[model samples]
Target: MNNFKTESFDLNRAFLLDSSHPPSSIVTKLHPLNKIMAEGQIHEDIPLLVMELDNQAIAFITPQLAYQHIVQGVLNGQAWLVSFCSICNGGAVFSPLVDDEVYSFQEGGFYDAMVLLYDVQSGSYWDHLTGNCLYGSLVGKELKRLSNLLHMSLRQVLAAYPDALLALSALPEQQQTEAEEDEAWRKASEPEWSKGLVKTLGVEDNRLPRLNMGLGVWTETTRRYYPVAQLYAMNNVLIDMVDGQRLITYIDPLSGTPGAFFTDASQAEWQHNILQLNNGDSMRDMVIFDANMMLKRPQRPFQLFVRWYSFALKFPNCEIYGQPVNTQG
Candidate 1:
């Protein structure tokens, strides 16, 4: 297995995408929902990177983020950065403030087979998945993660908040046709399109296939990865302990993505795409509890719906949910 180290910063291998001759371009500004609604609207079923701020539900279209790689914006007076790496099939929402100073970002390059984002203000490179500054003036700094970020469909987002705002692109005629959107979704769903990225990886971890998708949950002290296949094998719902907290994790039926929440409920089951908590109440989607709740309620851990190789490399010590424990005989 390969591990990422802060000490291994090489300028030559940084894959500087912001330089004059770059591989691709990124979106510098984010647009409001109403402005782009006339050109085209995101399909309700299309997955988006979303978060709730100040009782307002905001979403970042993933297809656009896949092409642009990064989008920076100010929402509810908070500076946010929504990022997606098509190669790694990973996405996250982050606060762009480092040392309480706001910073914009551009695609820097690639490190450890993942996207490295550099702040336009300090030119410091950061790991897109973990938000940790790797090299430059803010080498040891970290971007604050918006813990409530979830990968949900526009439909699911709307269900949660009927008037949720969709974040769009400010670029003129940036909307893709239905065919183009389908192609982008297909490429993201299947990682076979990333053969070129495979060539750029420094090392390969063979424990799990490079394209296997899973949910990776982490806290300041520990991390764990739960393969989707194993979750399905266990009836699409399972309970596990991570970072000293009991968590109920499942493949969300509405969006076909994974979600985890801190719960004290002893038993849970997936019934008709809704999770039934043993305590008479149920969870609709992403911990929207109905009736009496048995969960800790407020402590939703930081989780990422990511690929196996991506999580395995970044968190080398992560526990695999179904992996057998080894003991000395």
Candidate 2:
């Protein structure tokens, strides 16, 4: 409601030349197969096209449409703060309560997400070539498209979490037979609990790590001085924080309410949150702690998807090692 924007992805049908392909309904719904078919129409492979990049996927939807999504989805009700910590970079504590000029958290919203602009381009900490805006709308598309991408993006999965473990939730009780267990969920989610992780990771079957995210990404960095991600079979998708890596965690529940973006917050505050999430100097410190709730509502998950991807970009040489944990029947 703060401003308006738009883009479109209409599902169009295609008749395949191969009769061996499964029935149309099931074929179109299949992950790898469907993604391959959809790519020719979408103009690019959504998986590699979106996933190969770093920092918020940089969706190139129209600028106005992108900003509208930002305002409505997350900029509406959020609050923001900047760090003056000497660790990351000693600078301003600029808060909405303090200065209203250069750092306004009151009502004077930013003209653009960047500090400087030309005919229309803006300066950025990332994406120098594209001039992509950092607001959540333009960047945070991964979370929204996770389920779709997991199937379409790549045919193979590489489960490379630091602990070398996988937690597939939404499974069956031991009392049930193996065949019955797999059939019960029927691809609703990853196996509720998989046996291979315990055997392979050397973790006790009865033991699992408790959730302790006080350090945010710092603890994750301890294992490797960079971001880490491990792929699991769709049936092995997890709902809880898994081991030292909480792969599927969502934002604080309060931050996920509908219309959280700019709804109760002032325009200036909304814009401030956008900057902090995108490339504000203080954002670097955020990786050390939870920092403030940056996005308004649903985007917190999507935003993390981008940030994690960005972190990986920072480590181009990130060693990709680890034996693949098989999830097939």
The model with the greatest lDDT is 1
Q: Give the alpha-carbon lDDT of every model.
A: 0.70, 0.19
For each candidate, give its TM-score against the true structure: 0.83, 0.20
255-289 per-residue lDDT for model 2 (tens digits): 21011111111111122222122222111111211
Using TM-score as the measure, the top candidate is 1
lDDT of 2 at 210: 17
101-180, model 1: which lDDT tens digit per residue? Answer: 88878788777667778777776778887788878888778777774567887656655666667766543454455435
Query: Lowest summed lDDT over 10 consecutive residues: which window, candidate 2?
Result: 83-92
lDDT accuracy of residue 125 in candidate 1 = 79
